[model samples]
Target chain A: MSGITRDTLMAFVDGHLDPTGRTEVEAFLAANPEVAAEVALLQRQNDAIRTLYAPAGAEPIPVRLSVDRIAHSGRRRNNRFLTQAAAAVVLVGVGLAGGWLLRGNADTPGIADRLIADAVSAHTVYVLEKRHAVEVGGDEEEHLSSWLSNRLQTNLAMPDLTASGLTFLGGRLLPAPDVPGGKAAQLMYEDANGERLTLYITPRPGIDAPRTELASLGADTALFWSDDMLTCTITAPYSADKLEAIASAVFAQLNPSGDGYEI
Target chain B: MADILHEIEDAVPALRRYARALTRDVDRADDLVQDCLERAISRRRLFRPTGQVRPWLFTILVNLYRNSLRGQRRSGDTIDLSSIPEPAVPPAQPGHLALAELARAIDTLPPEQKEALLLVTLEGLAYKEAADILAIPLGTLMSRLGRARATLKTLTGAPAEPHLRTVK
Candidate 1:
């Protein structure tokens, strides 16, 4: 009580001092005028701060800021992410199925299998529709090539298959995470009967396998071949011989130099 | 569970008051409270059933506010000093005028001092509770409160009466 420190005085002002200590401080304050005045000013400041902003607490709480609403919204967001993840898995499964159908019994397809799977699945979904088949049609081949090449992050030339009784029907970009660039470009072709075929091409660097493989899964036959530069998977319902002939034409046209084209 | 929500609902006004005083911004204060409540509700299973939820919620709110301040600092965003509204000039009452000056002075303090001052003064929290919420030692909390008051005294100007008359 005799030695009233600043901490003790602050404790008194803040109501932290116990009753016995409070009585002691009160006695000290009675004896000390300057200290008591300071404490009073401190208390008033606290009062003023409260008066200025305390009304905010009394105002009605907005729904968006409510605890219940925030929790509910968080739950909804988590549910949506889970749904999207599930859809991705299903899409991958469909892509794998398409690969298996096209390359019936190829020894080992590697990344080409994946591209074929994705391309066939995309073709199956979009080819059935007469309209909305491609974002950029075959009529705009130069634009499609540049746009798809930019998106897929590589140089892509639209392969001419007119000699194989198929005409360019256009190309679409597909997500191909398993591939090197996380993207694939599928160029579609249509014959006189409106029968369709697709070439799934992606930049290939890390893939270590043979250059030629043919497999048939269901309705589609796929011929997968790769050189040092790129890998292409030709997926169609055509027989293996027919697909190989179309693939040779596609290979020569896609790589016009003939240096990268085998057979 | 319903009882807990109801208790939190009852404490919301007080929490908002404390948060607004802590943040000095309406939207930021509410965001802090919302984050605190969501964390509390989700982690209720870990909460001791017998423990009071009020102090826990306050702890969470304070931590979130501190984290946000740290983030803002890293991003190099200027602290918004202008957002704190100036206190209205009260009618000719001596205490009211002093209080208005005090409010502006509080806004000028370092964040730690301001936080300590509000917890003890505005929220009327016990020294121990305030220290616990701030994660500071009791001695540190007392010192901060002491420094805050001293700063306010200087900024708000000396009181009218110079002497303390002994009351019977």
Candidate 2:
């Protein structure tokens, strides 16, 4: 008989031995009851460990741990960090713009800045309102879409952000002192975590403005994008990439004529 | 890249099981798995297409688990094992190891031994794979497993090693 060392016995118990080696170990065990008993004891120890912890593998995984979700969020976070770095550079420019504001340009804060500030302020006020968060609830989808479209005069579609995990809470009308129509649509959304997002959209500012702008206000981020017809500033406490993702979805539905805003 | 994501997804359940055994807490285990997934997903470029995703993921998880323990130690946080929920299985029959007792005994094992034992026993990983994941030599892995089983036997009050019976 071959010398079946302690490691061999363990290999046997762990089922790591080859077929020939397994047969040899079985024969050895038959000849030696003491070693067989020891093997049985180790086997039971393994079985006990499996019984204690193996069920966790069989349980349903939570949504937050979904691989697709993790992968999506990871990619988004990288983009957001880059955007934040870019936003920092933009902040330096805002500092220059601030210099302009200090020099008697205060009353005429740029339309983009005015719109972002208003979006953030509206978001802060209404997100805390439990009973009256929106003038129209999301349940009235068709009416809400048409009413906001007619009010904004830009064929606005209630962007369905459900795909991005944001629920459309509803829409309301607010005054836009800087836009031609003097009317803006404030649409609110809530995510599964109860955090609120508001989109303040107005007719095109009728003045030359950068096609896109991003601002960080305390814990919130406001992103503004404009085409020839409408301008939208989305304000939320989410990171830039998350807002960017939602913005893409929002633009797809709101425009529907072409691909959503690029970059 | 897409292929790697699918491979990583397939390994999540086993990663979760090992993490659960290591942490003995569902929330903490899931949190560990999440962190592992995020790291693996982000650093996927480093993964070789020819390599197996399971062991790569297990290696990441084991390293993360060790790092977390280090952080906990530095922060002076002690895990209150009693606060963790007990195993859901029924009590063991007579002569079987009392599973709860065995679990506590397993918890008493040094992290290296616990990791090696579970990777082999519960995870049913190949000895070579477990050794690689633990970053230990095969011989060292065997000795750790031996020491772990011996300690568990004594802790759970199992019988002493049997002596050979002489043939007539």
Highest-DockQ candidate? 2
TM-score of 1: 0.53
Off by over 4 Å in 1: A67-263, B88-101, B159-168
Clash pairs for candidate 2: none
Pairs that collide, model 1: A99-A117, A101-A217, A101-A218, A102-A215, A103-A215, A103-A216, A104-A215, A104-A216
Question: Per-prediction interface RMSD?
Answer: 17.7, 8.9
**Candidate 2 on A1-263: residue-level lDDT in tens?**
55687788889889999999999989989998887887888888888888889889999999978989976652323233324333433464433333333353335556777677566656766888999999999999899989988988888888888898999899899877778988999999999999999999999999977566666665777778788888898889887656766776777676766533121
Which candidate should be chosen as best, given TM-score against the real structure? Answer: 2
lDDT of 1 by residue, A1-263 (tens): 54577667666776777899999988887777676776676666666666766776788987755656643443211222223222433554644554443344434334554554565566566677788777779999999999988987777889777877898889888776666777778888889998988888877746674465455545666666677667777778786546655766787777766443111
Deviation in Å, model 1, residue B134 alpha carbon: 1.5
Task: Name the Cα RMSD for model 1.
Answer: 21.1
Chain A TM-score vs. truth, each candidate: 0.56, 0.59
Question: What TM-score does each of the candidates earn?
Answer: 0.53, 0.58
Q: How accurate is candidate 2 locally (lDDT)?
A: 0.79
